[model samples]
Target: MSRIRATLVATAAAAAALLAPLAAAPAASAHGWITSPESRQGFCAEGATSFDCGEIKYEPQSVEAPKGSTKCSGGSSYTILDDNSKPWPRTTTGTTVTFQWKLTAAHSTASWEYFLDGVLYRTFDGGNKQPPSNVSQTIEGLPTGDHTMLVRWNIADTANAFYSCVDLHVVAGGTDPGDGGTTTPPVTTSPTDPTTPTSPGTCSAAAWSSSSVYLGGDQASYNGQIYRANWWTQGDTPSNTAWGPWTLVGSC
Candidate 1:
């Protein structure tokens, strides 16, 4: 009887251990962030685009706050995002720009809003449904010049919202300030001749994982090349197909 009881107890312990991860999965409020055009949190999370970022440099997707709040940091511990005086990298773009968000854990959303200089710019209604692994929307009518863009994702079922900020430099269409009238002689080379290969920039900060769902602007290294996802994808190798989800960015 003692031996049988010990065996049963061992089996129960094993089962509990296997179920622990599922029970401890991250809550819906714990995930999400803007990646494309590189939000303040996104830039710090990758350890790129140097700036004095606080704790956001560690976990960009973790910012959370109640709805109707306009603070850039979303009341997160990483309050450095609220500092606009610090020079942030600007993304050169047009009036109509597509913004992307990555969601590690999907939640029912009330709406997504964009702000410019403390004014509401655009809104995307989510209809209280779970959002996709990746979310993107094109915003138009932005005037040319430097502008601060803030994106907010309001949770429908909860009072909290996620926030991200990006600096943009919009330019007028068809205005090309070419090479200042300077020209260089073209160098000729044989098509069949072998040449020394060069490095492909830098490898991704993280390894690619099949179990992980990547969103736009997320970088991963696979098979010696670093890639940025154009949208949401999983288990896709970088630079393997013309229309593949991954965009080759560098070499690992």
Candidate 2:
């Protein structure tokens, strides 16, 4: 009986030791990403732009890598972000703009850096303290034209940083400064010619909407062509023919 009791005591001690580190471990590492003016990952996660975004569609906040990289992915494994060929929707704004960040796990910060066309333009100190879930940063005196802005959220406690890339079509005196989140509306044909197709053939389906959900076999007209959805999808442009959910049925 004494020997059996000793074995049980030893087993309990070992179990407690194994559980100690588990209890001390930190919580899940959830990071953040830009929302307003929509980063590349943001558009992919929202399914509003590209359809070929691999794993980034699920993990927009995970574009984290070591510091000192200029690429959109920041030298992370998310190489899709570095592909500028993707049709990232550009936000139409004036010379001044405000970027909104959505933080999932706001860690201790070092500084926020912004680069326009690979040139450092602004940096905000983080005071070495944790930040709130929602943080907004405004950048002023931007030049007018198409520009790619790279944002970095450097962590004070770690060598890693979160990166986001935003494409903007800055006009001399464009959108209201207060309307930082708004995007340029897509051009559409007149609705008075509903019976008449925008192209050569008759439009047999409704015009595709970015906000509408399309299921399998559903048809929609886009870019003078009629497309059929292979499966359920939303926010995916119908003109994406290569491996997208849309299949070009014919010209409308």
Candidate 3:
């Protein structure tokens, strides 16, 4: 009986040791991506039927970079979100639409911005507090046509921002465009030729300056390539490094 009791005590101690880390682990940081209108990352995560997306198909909530960039993927390794050549699934909605973001980990936010054709269409101030697991915002007065909508979440305390791209087909009062709708014009240039000219009226490349604070949607030229900043940033060079502030859009 004495031996048995000693063995049980040792077993209980081992079990307690195994459970300590689980009890002490910190809460996960904010991790999420847009779901409604099916953002590019969302579609990829859901196994998109229209196009073959890259790694983003598995982890939609992982597209994160420093605030002040405009790229859909925020310069993350999920660069597939930036590939505008492939036809994306479009969600048809009215001039005013409610966009929804699904969150796995909620974090305090600085703000949420919606961009249409590289223009700020709407913005929601988050008040620097934790939001619900699902956040929704209504945007109005969008022109009738196809538009690439970029949803950006700016974390209040962190330097990072989450990004998702939703290709939208807004109709004034007509029928839904369905998933097989018109495609937005491609914005990225081929990697084979860095100097290849992009579509007319697209964002032009400017020289990167450490003194300049770049906002989302701002483009810069560095190392013979054109990069788009995901959010406000300075001093981060646009190189081949992953998770940097700048996403390589094309060769300059």
Highest lDDT among the candidates is held by which one? 2
Per-model CA lDDT versus the true structure: 0.71, 0.77, 0.72
**Residue 207 accuracy (lDDT) in model 1:** 86
**Candidate 1 lDDT, 1-252, residue by residue in tens:** 999999999999999999999899646455777766677787776656566576666567778987776778877666788888887877787777777776767889999999987789999899999977667777778889998888999998887898888888889772211111122111112122112223665663588888897755577787777666655566766664544667565555
lDDT of 3 by residue, 104-162 (tens): 66889999999997788889999999988667776778899999999889999888898
Quote model 2's TM-score: 0.61
TM-score for every candidate vs. truth?
0.61, 0.61, 0.58
Candidate that beats the other on lDDT, 1 or 2, i.e. the better one = 2
lDDT of 2 by residue, 172-220 (tens): 8876333343322111223222222245578878999999977544789
lDDT (Cα, 0-100) at 136 in candidate 1: 72
Better of 2 and 3 by TM-score: 2
Error of 2 at 13 (Å): 23
